[model samples]
Target: MTDDLIGKQIGGYAILGLIGRGGMAAVYRAHQVSMNRSVAVKVLPRQFIDDLTYMQRFNREVQIAAQLEHRSIVPVHDYGESDGQPYIVMRYMAGGSVDDMLNAGPLRLDQIVQICAQIAPALDYAHGKSVLHRDLKPSNILLDDIGDAYLTDFGIARILGEAPGSTITTDGAVGTPSYMSPEQAQGHPLDHRTDIYALGVSLFEMATARRPFEGDTPYGVAVMHVTTPPPSPRLYNESIPVSVEQVILKALNKRREDRYDSAAALAAALRTAVEAPQASPPPDPQPSAPPPIEIQPLAERPIPAPVYPAPSAPSLRQVPPASVPKRKRRPFRLNLWVGAMIGGVLGCALLTVVVGIGLLIVGTSTSEVGPGETPTATADVTPSAHARALVNETAAAVESATPRTPTRRATAITNTPVERSGPSGTVIFFAQRPITVDGAPVEAYNLYSL
Candidate 1:
């Protein structure tokens, strides 16, 4: 269908122009004539409404995001059908997206930390509610005018308590490959930690000004993510501290067990890294010169009889060398160093065998005890009940410690067609400069710059 609706009214709202479009839908900045308020309306493409699968997913995005209300999450104001098209009306955010900021290159450490502080909370809240955002990337995060972070596009978020492995089985490989976690890339079921992995990828990209893996094609990049270890972020910017590197690595761990157990853990570690003493960059290695080449002299040659004087000198020289050769010096001492070196090697081998036997005996004794070894007063042990209580307490602390972000306010709303750039690019809600609050004339269209 052509986007020729410059001044068409639907559901009492007038559509001005196209604001932005993605693979699934387009966002439009529109004016609600009845309420005299502006709003951002996301509508599914008309072509896919007939396809049951795409339609179901489109409906799911609205249903899932609409139920949750958070400052970081774009609030869905309404959901309905207009002229055979399903659309969602959400609060229009004016600040832009994180992806836009990252396009400028690596962000300062402080900026990265601040962004994480804002997004981590949203992730934690979603996880708490048993929702896993299968797609968590910079493009999906928005920053308001106050520089606060908000997560948008929960189209692929999976709500827990449905079925076993509901997260992956419900939808196969549904996220952008560059930011997908290894498990998600493999189409395996995911948990809270999976989102943590994607967030780590985003943080890495933010700090390095590039994605961890990139190739000729999306599939190639997906393979890299699954197989390659991320390059050191410090390589791009030496100012990145070691503590931050450790935090990033922990979250990017290939195995879920090795990653931060929860978003709060990652957020806490990030805060600590930010507060910890900064480390000095390592000194560059000194360049070395090429080695010198050895030279050899040509063998001496005897002169011909034609040179009478040269022949006499050669005869005298030969006489002196022969006299010296006759008196070959006897060796001052036998080569005893070789024998000493061999003796030392033998002694080391003997010592190694003795240590091996000792270690074997200790291992056997430990196994026989079957963890029943009594502890001396030096070793403190808790009773089974106390140990269980400690375990429960630790679990509760982990659950409680996950980080979350506070909600922020949006300055303007758009429901017309848009041109979405990287998420953080400056967004204009209207077609022209200076958005009108009294509702610009229905015919006076303004383009929103984002």
Candidate 2:
């Protein structure tokens, strides 16, 4: 039945293609012929056309959505019935919904912040008008080509003045289980805080890329929303600042009163947390260690000079030649007393020799008694006592000076080569026997021929 709507004219709009489907309605891309502009047309499905319950809800969406006018709210342009099926025409969002962005991947912080800035205030504005968007989730929020956020789908919303204490549904819960507040999960009365809780869930998904609590069934997840405390946002995204996590926790508080007073307050707190400057780190308990001091190596240090004699000093003395060195000769010295005694002994000997000669001359002198007779010098060969003693001393000195001849002497015969014996056969032997003149033997050699 939805496919047959393709190329079909509905209220001066040509149907193009189906954009997406939801429990509330099916949205399609279409062109309004009168304005020559593109628009999003949401139509109630064929199965629910006969159901009064859905039909009335569809009609209520058309009425409420047209009343909202803001920069961040999707403007309702037209609404009409085409052949028993109700359809709503709204300004087409070229960038698609936040659900599409979540399906692709987690959103960036700047984009999420920018989006929240637009949508959060829009929600606050709606709440101020006594309008409560009971079903506020990612799918209900749309974005334009320039990343401008626009809140849509006021289908399950309530004009709070019409019914404040009554439940949005008569049979069961109305909002998404994962995003539902604790009171909404328990079927208790709800206020603007429910939407704030849902926005916290969407922020959680944008930061962590996953819902805080997950289960096999919607009832189980809803039970966790009511009973369990929200897990820390930093648990999923460690890069999230502690301040930002605190803001998320405050917005997701179980009790509605504990949460931010308004959606604008939540957005303001989030912005301040994100844009807030990082705090200065605490000072360390102990002082920093000192820089290391480098020590010189032993090999690089200069050696000290020797204590006794410096090794680097040069010698002053000159070196001699390699040949033998000559020794110095000392002058001779004689004693004066010894020289005098030697001179005295020589004088005595000379005097004795002179006197002996004089005595011999006197003894040999002839008396001149007869002049006529030729003076013949008839001399006695005898010396006076003094002279005789001198002659005796001289003889003794000469005898002692003579060298003694010995017997059995070896004589080298070089006179003739009689036996050709150079040092042996030509030798003679002489033995002496002294003829003593009554007492002493004389030193002589008597030769014996061989």
Candidate 3:
């Protein structure tokens, strides 16, 4: 059916090319002949025209999406049936979907915040209108060329205040399993908070590059959403701020009551977190130096008493003349004793210096040789470039393996053009007028209605 509709004209709109296919409809790039504008057309397959459930869902999506008039929502231009196939014409978006960006890598923190901020207000507006986007995931988020986000795909949305059991339900569970909130997974009645939970999941993936929960099958994943606690975003990407993680965790609370009261509240938290200063980790402690050693001055030595050499004088037999008065040898002996004491002190000082030098050498050699090895002089070897690179790489690997406290940087919000006004009696166009899905002028449609 998609192949046949590529060049075929349906309901006065010529199908230019196929955009993509979904479970229930195929979106195509089409030229609205009557309006002379290029638009995206989501066409239901011919096989599903006869199916009551699919037809109801298709009509419901058209009704819900057409009434939504906001900057962050894809505006529906027309809806009609041709050749037993149903299709809805919407403003074409050229920048593709958030899933496309996620495929490349995890988005920057600032980008995630900006995207969430855009989506939050959109969800709040829908909630105000009694609309619940049951299936809110990255794939349903469309982006513009300048990176503005728009929420699309309300196929499974439930309209509040409508008759009970009026909308389609599959086995009581109707949302994508991976992004389903706890209540949605349990097949319980839902409210706006379910959409908030799904948005939290999308934000988690945007920040962490992976969903918080995973399982082998759809049912298993759904079960995890109900039973498991979401891992912290910092666990995947250490740079994610604590405040940002807190906001996400609050949005993903298992109990709806614990989650954000409204999308506006969630958006407010995100904005505050993005603006908050990041707390830095404490510095590592340094080793202390050894204390100084004090040396005491040597005490003065007492003079030795003159020694009488009676026995030595007899042996020498050299008696001095009386006139000479036998100059008391005490002075000479005293001088000699002083010289001997000085020499002994110098010798002790030299021995101490030699011991200290030897000890220092032994300590250094032991450290270089490491434990349980005899000390030997090692030849200095210059490493080749390849070996040096390998060593550096190995050291880096080890350093990375040794987990350190994660540090986060405050993400400054860049001055990107964003639409912030809610649904109001007056509409104002900000920087860069809204362009069509194909980057063409949007004519014949009031993209925003007061």
| CA deviation > 4 Å runs, candidate 1 | 164-169, 278-450
Model 3, span 5-101: residue lDDT tens? 8888988899999878889989999898888888899999888888998998899898899878889998888898887788898988888899989
lDDT, candidate 2, at 8: 92
Q: List the candidates ranked by TM-score, beginning with the highest.
A: 3, 2, 1
Better of 1 and 3 by TM-score: 3
Q: What does the lDDT read for residue 274 in candidate 1?
A: 76
lDDT-wise, the better of 2 and 3 is: 3
State the lDDT of candidate 2 residue by residue for 179-250, as single tens digits: 888988897766788899989888888777888899999999999998899998889889887777777788
Cα RMSD for candidates in order: 58.7, 23.0, 50.8
Model 1 per-residue lDDT tens digits across residues 1-450: 678655776676788777678778888888877778877788888789898777877888877887677777878887888898888887766667788888788887888888888788888888888888888988888777788888888887888778754433266776889988988888887788889999999988888888878899989988887889888878877888877877887788888988888877777788778786454221234566588876545565544478454444344444434444467665343234643464455446534643453454345445555465652221222323533444345334432432221322222544464443322222223222222212221112232221
lDDT accuracy of residue 179 in candidate 1: 87
Q: Which stretches of candidate 3 lie over 4 Å from their true place?
A: 169-171, 278-450
Residue 55 lDDT (model 3): 93
Pick by lDDT: which candidate is best?
Answer: 3
lDDT to native, each model: 0.70, 0.73, 0.75
Q: Count the backbone clashes (under 3 Å) in each candidate.
A: 37, 0, 2
